[model samples]
Target chain A: MASFLEFRQVTVAFGDYVAVEGVSLALAPGAFVSLVGPTGCGKSTLLNVAAGLLAPSRGEVLLEGRPLKGLNPVAGYLFQQDAILPWKTALDNVALPLVFRGVPWGEARERARVWLEKVGLGRFLRHYPHQLSGGMRKRVGLAQVLIAGPKLLLMDEPFSALDIQTRQLMENELLRLWQEDRKTVLFVTHDLEEAIALSDRVVVMSAGPRSRPIGDFPIPLPRPRDVAEIRLTPEFLRLHREIWELLRGEVLRAHAGA
Target chain B: MRGLRVRLWQAGLLLGFLLLWEWASRTGRIDPFFFSLPSAIAQRVWRWFATGEVYPHLYITTVEMLLAFALGTLLGVVFGLWLALAPAVAAVLDPYVKALNAIPRVVLAPIFTLWFGLGVLSKVALGVTLVFFVAFFNTYQGVKEVSPLVLQNARLLGAKPSHLLRHVYLPAAASWIFSSLRTSIGFAVIGAVVGEYLGSAAGLGYLIAQAEGVFDTTGVFAGMVVLMAFVLALDALVGTVERRLLVWRSKEREGGSA
Candidate 1:
């Protein structure tokens, strides 16, 4: 099958500093792919390239066999920080993508209402981002991105700010949402366990000044895995050890450089 | 109950101050000729209202203030967004913006009167100058500080330039603009009154200046009191609008739990 999204020898640099160099990645349609790396590993830069927010200095990103010239036309990005409009209610924020697409106000709002309910925020339609808890805001963010119905979902450490318990719940929530339609996702994170638990294929990236993917591991874990309960399984532990062994050296190198 | 208590204390303080002033004037502790009795000022204000003598002056001042504020805010927001989004232009115009901002805007009142010829336009021009910087600086900062993550996410979700401006940029800058409303209104009042005080056919400032010319201290005191009341009313209106527009921020401060 043709890749839904492909990066061809992509490189990004900030003047004298090269953030990522010669990085090539691909995601098949409806696949769950996680890009994991140590701090400062250019995971976000790669994600930005895929989203077409930042054009690569060297190579290009191809979406469905065509080179993307500008912002990706069929992608939704969930940022690490709170990206929802602070002035808007949850309902308005969720309705925004539709609104931007020139959807009529009434119909867009009706659809947004459905999406908000799907994310379990039926009672929070009128609540502002500030009024919602960290986890609730994350749910709102999820609803916001998914409401747009993009083919490619790009998430950059979206739940890193949440506590451990909230993180697991959000992880499970993400999985549940992904299971419904299984849209192609390029999720970036530093958490090894999260990558193993939520992803079908985990791609590890090396530390920067010049960062690129160093290893790719395919997880043969069973479907419908619980993020919290999966940790105790023997197979899960073995995969964690194998990936962590390769990830630990790069993490130490990043720490020493910092 | 706490709000009511605070209001009662506020009213009590005002009443005590007025009573003391009236008593002191009556007892010959202070010369009523220069200081003016509180009762005399109150009576003057009452007669002006009853006979409708102050209506035209009040109308002129109100119109001028509103025009200046509306026009200034509009121009400020437009120019601010324009310059902030264009880094090359912003760098080129940096020194000039600082220089213009540094000049005492009050000095421009005389020039404005001379150029616009002491009508409502002169006051409005002066007011615009005063209010413009307050709105401009706040708006400039607001646009410049919009979250990069939000912009990126919006683009990935298929927001065009116009869509981003309407949905993201305007809403982001609105908080900053609303915050500066009170300050800009105050500047508007200053510009209108000062322009009229210098030279104008009608306005609250003209009334005060006319009274001072003839040494009618009571009329001057009455004018001052009316002006104070007018400003307070305008401020209260601004407070209402701000609360309505920035409900998200206020809720954030309240820390409403999800």
Candidate 2:
């Protein structure tokens, strides 16, 4: 199978501090991949590099064999903080990508309404970011990216701030979106269960200043998986243990660095 | 019922103040020559309006105020957006803008009359000067305070620089701009009145100056009442526009409360 996205020996730096060093990874088309690591392990930095928000100080990022130069609109990003604009209604926020692309206001809003409905926000289309609960805001944020119809999605800990129940519900909603759209997704999170529950493959990273992937574990669990049922599986437990073991030392080292 | 109660309370307060003023003037506790009774002022205002003496002055002041307000606000928003987005430009112009803002703008009325003549132009110039800084500073602060995370999300969504400005920066700064507009209304009125006071043959300010020269306290009070009414009307119009544009915002608040 051909690689859809490639990060070849990518190194990202801010002045003297290198966030990611000599890191290499490739993702298949329409694949669900998760990067699991301790906080500050540069998972977000790697994602940023992929999204072309940060310039790689070394090596190259290729999208479908073409060198990525600037921001690629084909890649949609969902931030950890929801980042829905406080001034915009849920529908308007969802339609923002279309607006940026110069779609007419009436049509863009109509399309935005469609996406809001998809994310179960049909009733709250006129609601602002501040008006929505945390879970609903996250859903709105997801709808924002999804409405753009990007071939690749980059999510940075998109559900980290939500409560456990809401997180699970959001995870289910995300999985449903992913299943329906079949877009390639690169999700970054520290939750082992979440990584195991959602991804086709989990890339585990060591701590930063020079963070790189230390393990790549394939999740063999069948698709259309329920969060509760998946957690009950021995395979899920085994993968969780493997990832936890790989991440344990890195987490400790990150704490020590802090 | 709640809205009605609030309205009743406001009306009662206004009536009580009017009664007190009327009592003070009728009882000779306050000099009617210097401080005309509210009833006398009202009578004078009615006669002024009935004879169409108030219309020309009202028209003159309103035109000057609206023109100055539009010109000042447009320039302020443009310059403020420019300064906030460009660090080098902001650094270079920061001191000059601050110095201009800090100076007493009312002192410029005479200079404006000298430069633009004793016609409407001078009043407009004065009003523009008064209104500009309030809008400029507020818009500058607003654009500068746009959340970094939101900007990142926009970039990730493939928003071009212009798109970012239109969808993110402008909307982010809108509430701030509206807030400044409310303040700028008073400044705009001050600018026009000050210019007229310095040199003009028409406008409510000119009427007041004439009344003061003749010791016609009723006429002076009537002019002030006219000015106050005009300002309040303009403020109400601005408020209406704000409510329309911010419909999405209030809906969000309602959703949150529910």
Candidate 3:
């Protein structure tokens, strides 16, 4: 069977700067993958390609055997930033995707309320984005992306700014939610530990000017993994060490380049 | 308690200033002919109000102000969004917009009188010109400056063009557009009155012009006072609307960033 999404020989350039080069990757339906790389190593550019936010300067992005165009209809994106509209209350922000999808306002709001409750933001219905804490806003962002039920999820370091405790809690929440139906996810982050803890496979990329995947490691961890508990295991540590070895060199190169 | 204290201070300051002015004019510290005694001005204003002579002029000026405000704001938002969304079109129009903005729109009062005649049409036309650019620039900036990340997330979540405009563009621009509306209220009123002052059959501007021609210092002062009152009332109206519409932002200011 065809992989649900494919990035074939994708290269992205902005004027004189080449962000990503000759990158080919595939994701099976329901797979969870994390792309780990150094800062400015084209992780976000790659993610944007998947989201169809930026067309690759070279190569094609295919979704379910179709060449994707404009915005990818099958995917939802969670930005590194909260991305929740500050002008909207938590409930309204979560309901925004549904409203865009032509759902009736009443039903969209009802579903958004349920989703917000699921994300543990039941009491923050009327609270604006600014009123909520960062974690609360992130939860709102999660509810916003998930409420629309896109088949593929693209998250760009969605929790990199959170305190560790909040990060772990949100990671576990994401896992629990994703487990209800194993949705395909493409998560990008610089943190190797985070990559290994949350994803079924971790792909490491070299530093830019022409960043491309250096290694792909399929995680052998068991299902129903607790992100916090799984970290204490030797297997997680070994995988972390191995991925860090591959990633640290690229990070150093990026730092030198900067 | 704090708000009341501030209001008390404001009232005291206003009363003190008025008393000082009244005392100075009455005691011949300043020439009453040019400065105009505050008491006489007050009496003149009262007479206009009591005798209902101000109504027709007020009505004409207000209609011109409202029409200018409504038309300018609508055109500004629509055109601003269009230009922001279509960069190519914006590029073409960029020079023209800037050139129009650079010219003092107040100077167009005379030209508007020639184009639209010595009626409310001329006044409205002048007011529209004054109000448009401020609103347009603000709306353009508001739309242009929407967080690209937020926009990307919206698109990935399946927001279509129409949905993007309603949910993202308008809400992002809401505060800016409203700010422009508030600022342009003063300009609109100025435009109408200035146009009328230049040449007109009826309006507060005409009344002021009539007073100025006869060197009736009290009438001029009263007209000035009436114009001030009109502007304050309109500003208050806008302030009320802003408070209601931007309730979400108010919550943001009160809440600390989480």
Candidate 3 - CAPRI tier?
A: medium
RMSD of each: 2.6, 3.0, 2.5
In model 1, the runs with Cα more than 4 Å from the true position are: B1-5, B251-258
Q: Please report how far candidate 3 places residue B142 from its true position, in Å.
A: 1.5
How many Å off is the CA of B179 in candidate 1?
Answer: 2.5
Best by the lDDT measure: 1
Order by DockQ, highest first: 1, 3, 2
Clash pairs for candidate 2: none
Per-model fnat list = 0.87, 0.70, 0.77
Cα lDDT of all candidates, in order? 0.90, 0.88, 0.89
Q: How close is candidate 3 to the true structure, as a TM-score?
A: 0.94
Tens digit of lDDT per residue, candidate 3, span B57-171?
Answer: 9999999999999888888888888898999999999999889888887788788878888889988988888788888888888887888867777777777899888878888
Question: Which pairs clash inside model 3?
Answer: none
TM-score of chain A of each: 0.98, 0.97, 0.98
Decide which is better by DockQ, 2 or 3.
3
Lowest lDDT 10-residue stretch of candidate 3 chain B:
B249-258
- TM-score ranking from best to worst? 3, 1, 2
Q: Assess the local accuracy of residue A191 in candidate 3 as a C-alpha lDDT between 0 and 100.
A: 87
